[model samples]
Target: MSGGILEGDRNMGLIRAQLRRQRVLAGMNQDEFGKRTNYSASTVSAVETGTRAMDTPFAARADEVLETGGLFVSLLELARRDGQPRWFRPWLDAERAADQLRCYQPTLVPGLLQTEAYARAVIRCDDKLTDAQVEQRLAARMDRQSILNKDEPPQFVVVLDEIVIRRVDEAFHQALADQVHRLIELAERPNISIHIVPADIAIHVSLTGPFILAKTADGGWVGNLENQLGGIVVDKDDALATLLSRWETVRNEALSRRQSTELMKEVVKSWT
Candidate 1:
């Protein structure tokens, strides 16, 4: 439990260290601590070792278990803001608070729908990322999917370019197959819908990168555009309007839900 297991992510490091110390002082191993918190030992180990991002619910549970009176919760709030690069925080907040998320991805599945292995394969594309950084991000991405399973989760309308499902990478072959199955499972939920833009689509307007428009509680929209570098949050009226236009165009190009699922099933067989 020392020397940058999480690669000197001090904010995360401090959280993990403190949690570990508390469990030790209470004479509880990870399995014992996990039982008190109603989680598994593996989950406890992941959090304590910084391989998993400690989520808010777990923080609350920890506070209750260790009688820390919300100390873990407070620390987690800071970790949430500072754990990742500064630029991504605003949209992360917006996404968490959004009631409706409209997503369009041209090359991959949206983060909200990606399976754990699929997310890991995608994040590994960045060679510069350390193992700790990748695990941190991968955990965060998996945690983000929880929003869709919450009580009365948001209405998620996702449109993906056909290649997202059709394109196969030799390295990600198995992960991609599992991802398609995950997509189908999630789409079965009433709140989730997946649409696919067929390969025949020759439109260039939607080629301007993938973007998501989230309708916040205040009835305004926030946009997140992803690229090779990072993501940008869109809030200005004019910029949001342009995103709206682009979203509408690609969404129109997408097949209906049933048709898209059928197409995905056809592509899944190709994996074998």
Candidate 2:
């Protein structure tokens, strides 16, 4: 086997060992641990033995029950990093460590802000992914949201195209409503802001694409461009500058925070 495969197996083994050890230290048998985490004993066993991959929800619940102080969450991230394309890992690292995040989404709702149902619906659109793969991806996406709950969460500013709110399907009405409510709740946090760019805006730099610019603790910036195929981490000075320029232009086209909130409320009302 190739080195990459070998490394992945090793990392997975570490996760399995860590999870079993933590459970034992907590003095809980597999059945007891499963009960605490709201998973079946067989499912817990599968994860412990590496027959199944750990999902974000399971990791979070395990961390809480085991009092591991986020250890399981860290392991879950490492496992996810191992599975992702190499080009995406640096962006993931930047996202976890950044002091500030600026994002523009012209398509669907941003992954960080999506509700579970909305996320499931979005992931289901990909015909290539199997049910298990979809579940794993959903768990990882949900886990990333934990960053917002951290004591010193990053300052987040997100700009969404107005069409994103209006594009929801009738089947997702309730889920979309919950998602909009979630956006409203998150926007209320002093460190987070959400803006909506009017659909009528005839011109904007974000027309180029959706991107995120993260400001790291060491006063450096990293950018990411994401699309259907995959994601690219941007670190080159010229590229970063362009992304920042586009972000500013898009933010200028978006409504103010209060206006965006009111608009979102109006949209939520229409979901019924």
Candidate 3:
């Protein structure tokens, strides 16, 4: 296996050992621990055996039940951190402190805007993950949305290719409809804006791939390119400038907020 995959497995093994030790320290059997975490005994056993990945919710609940004072939560974060590519870590850090975020997606809906079911569907596309691992990742993704709820949330703007809305599968039709409505609701927030790039757009810089530009609280700018394998943080001044220019060009090609909302409404109706 690849080094990255091996590292992830090692981290998960450590997490499982820690979880099992903590449960023992609490004088709880698998069934008892399962009761606290709202999971079945078999599920708890699976996590302890490293056959299932432990999710954020499970960590929080376990920490509370075992009175570990967030130890499990920390371990869960560690496992997640280990699983991510090194290059993507900086972008995750920058996102938390960003004063403004601008993103352009040509394929899937941006993670921050996805609903729970939608997020689960996206994560499940990774066939390597066990059902438990998928749930773990899904919970983590959902937790990231808390950033949007901050009192002084970042000003966020997303420009999505029109195909993103039109490419719904039948199984997720209702969920996707809810997601469109969610976009509309989020757009009503003063700090958020959502735009759509018409499918017939003659040309655009965003055709290259999905990218995010974040303006940090201290005024520094960070650019990130996300791909299937991993992510890259573009920090060089020359590269940042080029990405910013492309962002402006793509933003210009996107429909206005009102028009995008109208189009979203139309799409939602078709899903019915």
Model 3 over residues 238-265: C-alpha lDDT tens digits? 9999999999999999999999999999
Ranking by TM-score: 3, 1, 2
Q: How close is candidate 1 to the true structure, as a TM-score?
A: 0.85
What are the models' TM-scores? 0.85, 0.83, 0.88
For model 1, residues 96-147, the per-residue Cα lDDT tens digits are: 8889999988888998898889888888887877787777677667767878
Top candidate by TM-score: 3
Misplaced by over 4 Å in model 3 are 126-136
State the C-alpha lDDT per candidate: 0.84, 0.84, 0.85
Q: Lowest summed lDDT over 10 consecutive residues: which window, candidate 3?
A: 1-10
Q: What is candidate 2's lDDT per residue for 1-272, written digit by digit as tens? A: 12323455577678889899989988999999999999999999988876676877788899999988998888777776675567777888999999999999988788888998999999888776656566666766787888888999999999999988888666877788888899999899999999999878977768878899999999999999986667788999998888888888889999999999999999987765
Residue-pair clashes per candidate: 0, 0, 0
Runs of candidate 1 with Cα error greater than 4 angstroms are 1-8, 29-65, 69-74
lDDT of 2 at 234: 90
